[model samples]
Target: MNAFMKVQNLHKIYGDKVVLNKINFDLKEGEFLSVLGPSGCGKTTLLKLLIGIESQTSGKILLKGNDISQLNSSKRNMGIVFQNYALFPNMTVLQNIEYALKFHETYKKDARKIALEVLEQVGLTEHMNKRVDRLSGGQQQRIAIARTLALKPDVILFDEPLSALDAANRLTMRQEIKRIQKEYHSTIIYITHDQEEAFTMSDRIMVMSEGHVEQLDTPLNIYNHPKNDFVNDFVVKHLQTKLNDLEKCMVKDYD
Candidate 1:
């Protein structure tokens, strides 16, 4: 597993308040890493910094071993899917996907071809000609994903991408996103507050508190072996009560 993205001593501040403090992590190629935390825990801020939407106050970001801290959003070759889907209301499904490729200039002549292919990948080929507003929320989200995929970016950042959907829709989209990432072999950084979603979708989960990373590990370890009291209380919400005799004896001793 090659390191596709790296963050070193990442820090962000607003006025006199620090939002992120000396954060560090590395994402492997073709890996799906989820940032999970409560609201205002800097999960979204970390995603923004990865995609170049927000600059870090200090530290470095490396993409494929190249420093990208100073690179503009478009130059970073990263795609981002926002929580709201961010589809172009005036453009058809095909046109929306093609927009990302327009930066290549040659895309103008072959936009439809590229767009249709991406739409088909996301199971939206039948809706290629339909206006974005005509599609359902789930369909629009697929369109947004297709548009980002069309760019063939090195990394994709998802900023609570499924937060807007209903329970059923969220479940459906979660599977779709997993499928798309596997098919494309794309490195994905997904941010979410939903523990179930993180557990189900992430190759690994990074648990954040306030502005710092408490633990970064596989989902099972994160749930069963949290690093501190905060992680224990915040991340691990439930545990099995099937105690063995020894454990029951320990409880009796405490009592």
Candidate 2:
């Protein structure tokens, strides 16, 4: 299959610092791809470039064979969910979702219908009447996602979206996001530092360090055959330690 979205020789620089260095990748249609890296590794910078919030210093961004490198964020046909749920505290859940659709030329006339539909899609229809600030962290996150889903963009970018949640909420939202993505048949580029989030949710994972890709492959392939020391240490070893700790807890429980 041809690439649904492609980036070639992407780079971002600030004065003497190189934020993203000659990066390149392809994303298949309806595929879930995660950009995993530690802080200051350019994961978020990559997202900003993809979503058109920031321009690349030099590169091409192709969406379905069309060059969108010069397009603004709204013209890119992409949606992004920030780590903080960017919601209106004063608005109802339904209104929060509907508000965004009002600005969308295609959905504006039917904003209410679209908002209601996405609310249902996120399993938040029952909370539609609640004020945004009144909901739990997970519920608020769902509303943020619902608002984005209302626009029905071609691709969605998630930037550490589950980071603010408690461990239990984070796990639950991970499942929620995966389910929503599958149901929507959505193409996703999820940015995260959490190993389990990327491994469990992605069809493919792109590991980056110091602004360059270390590896990009299926989660199983990455885990079993790391491309280099960075992949082994940053991805595999970290996950292994988590597994070891969990096993020790299980052993203690059995005793």
Candidate 3:
């Protein structure tokens, strides 16, 4: 079977500055892949291109073997959860999620059913009547996810969805996201600067540095053996704590 999605020779430029350079990768069906990088490394730019939020300067983005690089965001059948959760403050949680079905076929019959189903999946069934602004950050994020999943898109793009949350909220949202992904078996491309976040929840990680793909591999391999100097240095700081713990395990404490 072929990959569920393929990016070929992708490049994006802005005037004289290049933001993405000859990027390439394949995402398998139901795979959870995280794009990890520092700010301005083109991680968000890449996600934009993937979801058709921004047109690429050059290259092809193929979904299920058809070119979708030039397709409009709505026509791409891809869902995105923005960093801020992008919920409508004026709407209640159920209304926020049900809004995604407006133009969809499901809008005619039982839109409320689909919306409630997704709310239950995200553990927010009871809070459906509450306005999003009144909820905590983690709850808001779940509503964002419920809205996206209600559409049942072929692929999901998360653009630093937890970045705006506090440390506790971030941790809670992370586990919630992992649970939802596992339950739905959705193909997801998550973008984040947090190494622990990427390592904890991804099947594979694509490490980017200044518009280039430094490495693409499983989290364990990326942690134990980075592909290049950039990757090694990038992961070293995050790996130190794990390395120290392992070393301490070898030397039993006499307490």
Candidate 4:
């Protein structure tokens, strides 16, 4: 597939300090690409730049061969689902989902219909009448995703969306998100520090460090053939440790 979105020679600078250093990547349509890295690795900064919240010091952000790096956030036609869920607590799920659609000319006329459709897409139709604050974490997250879907964005960006959930809820939401992506035919850029989360959900994983991409490839290839010490130590070794711990627990259970 052709590159649906491209970030080339991207750089972000705050005074004398550089936050992102000549970063580059290509994203395909309807692909789930996870940006995996530890905290303060410039992953969040990259998201902000792509979404137009932050301007790149230098570089081009091309969407379908058009430069959109300078566009305002609202004009970018990209949706973001934050870790906090960022819903209106007092509003019902239906209202929260309908809120953003009012700003879109094409969707505003049929806001309720679109909202309900997205709510059903995320499997939160039954909770539509409930206040967002009254729902559990997982339900609230689905609402947030449903709200984003209502606008019918070209690309969806997730900023460590499941990091706030408990283990059970996180696992459940993972499946929900993958289903939504497939059914909605969305292109997603998921940001996460969890190796397992990236491995399970992403079509390809982009490993980053200190504002640079360490490796960008399939999860299996990254695991089997690491490009350098950082990729091996950060991604491979960490996943291996988790597997070793799981093996010990399984052996104990059998004994």
Candidate 5:
């Protein structure tokens, strides 16, 4: 079966520099996957390419088997939540989310109503009237997510969405994200440099390095049985500790 979302031979270059070189990957429908790598590893560039924020030098990005490489960002229907939340500081929480719906001709008329429902989904109903600056980082991130969900896009791309939050809040949001993804049955591609974050939230983690894919597999397999030295050295050195931490976070969701 073909993947619900696919990237084939993706490459990006700027003058003399190559950012994403011959990249290839895919996502099954409703699957939550992460592209894990360190800073400057081209993960963010890959996100940009996938979303059409920047066109690839050469490659194909297909959504449901249709080539969407040439489509603009808005046409792709891939929503993104940036690390900084990207909320309009002047807008209220409700307004920030409703702003996204205004661009979708179908939802433009019902923007406010749909925004309220999505806010409730993210557990932010009470803060609906709050100014964007008044909310906490976690709350703001939820607003970003709510804004994205309001679009009802084909795929959601999270560009290191949790990296800006404090550790405790990051843990909380991790579980919340998993719950929300399940609730929406959404297909997602999460970009992160933190192995623990990727391992904690993803069904599978794609390890990347210097514009190359090192390995792609379940977290346990990538951690316990790394396919290469970079995978072992960069992602597997902690082993049991990450597993313990991962289990503890999952357990916290029920507590």
Candidate 6:
């Protein structure tokens, strides 16, 4: 299968500091790839580069074999959902979603139709005419997602999108996101520090640390056979106590 997106030796620098270092990866069409990392690990920076919000200091980004390294943000054909929802306070829920489709010359009327459908998918159709300020955090997050979907972009990049919601709402939204992505058959690059969220939502997970990718594999493989001490420590730190104890027993067999 052809890769829908590819990053080759990507590097990003902010003056004297490096934000991303020699990053390389690829996403197949309809794949859900979660980038798992702690804060300040450059995961968000990677998302920004993919969407053209930030430029890479070196290397190339290819979307379906077209180099998009110098493409304008608006031309990237990628949708992004930020942690803060990024909704316009004055716009109604439906209007906010419709805004994303304004640039698509062929889809003006269809945009509204699609936006409404996405709102319904997110359980926010009743809130369509309501201003963003009136909605709860979860509701606003759903609006953000709906807005992104309205663009019908080739790829979706989510930057810690569920971080601002409560636990219950986060869980609900996580499942909704998974379902929506599959429904659209969209390639997704999701960034989150939450291990459980990554494991639950990702078809594959890339563990990043200190501006580099430490490992990329299926969640089960990441948990069972971490490549290095850092990954092993992270797995132990994040796993439940029972699971941690089980890992110890499993490790003994390897010893």
* lDDT by residue (tens digit), candidate 4, 1-255: 559999999999989988899999999999999999999999999999999998999999999888999999998889999999999999999999999888788998999999988887778888889999999999999998988888888899999999999999999999999999999899999999999999999999999999999999999999999999999999999999999999999999999
Error of 6 at 73 (Å): 1.1
Q: Which order, best to worst by lDDT?
A: 2, 4, 5, 3, 6, 1
**Local distance difference test, candidate 4:** 0.94
Candidate 4 at residue 224, lDDT? Answer: 99
For candidate 4, the per-residue lDDT at 234 reads 94
In candidate 4, which residue pairs clash?
Answer: none
Candidate 1 regions off by >4 Å?
Answer: 238-255
lDDT of 1 by residue, 1-255 (tens): 547888999999999999999999998999999999999999988888888888999999998889999899888989899999888899888878887687676466777788888887899888888999998899999888888888788998898988889989999999999999999998999999988889899999999989999999999988778889877777675322323555898999999
Query: Can you give the lDDT of residue 46 in candidate 1?
Result: 88
Regarding TM-score, does 3 or 6 come out ahead? 3
The global C-alpha lDDT for each of the candidates, from Candidate 1 onward, is 0.88, 0.94, 0.91, 0.94, 0.92, 0.88
RMSD values for the candidates in order, in angstroms, are: 6.1, 0.7, 2.5, 0.8, 3.9, 4.9
Residue pairs whose backbone atoms clash in candidate 6: none
lDDT of 2 by residue, 199-235 (tens): 9999999999999999999999999999999999999
Error in Å for residue 91 of model 3 = 0.8
Query: What's the residue-level lDDT of 225 in candidate 2?
Result: 100
Model 5: lDDT equals 0.92
TM-score of 6: 0.91
Per-residue accuracy of model 6 over 42-156 as CA lDDT, tens digit each: 9989988888888899999999989999999888889889999888999899889988677688778688788888888888989899999998998898888888888778998
Off by over 4 Å in 6: 242-255
Clashing residue pairs in candidate 5 are: none
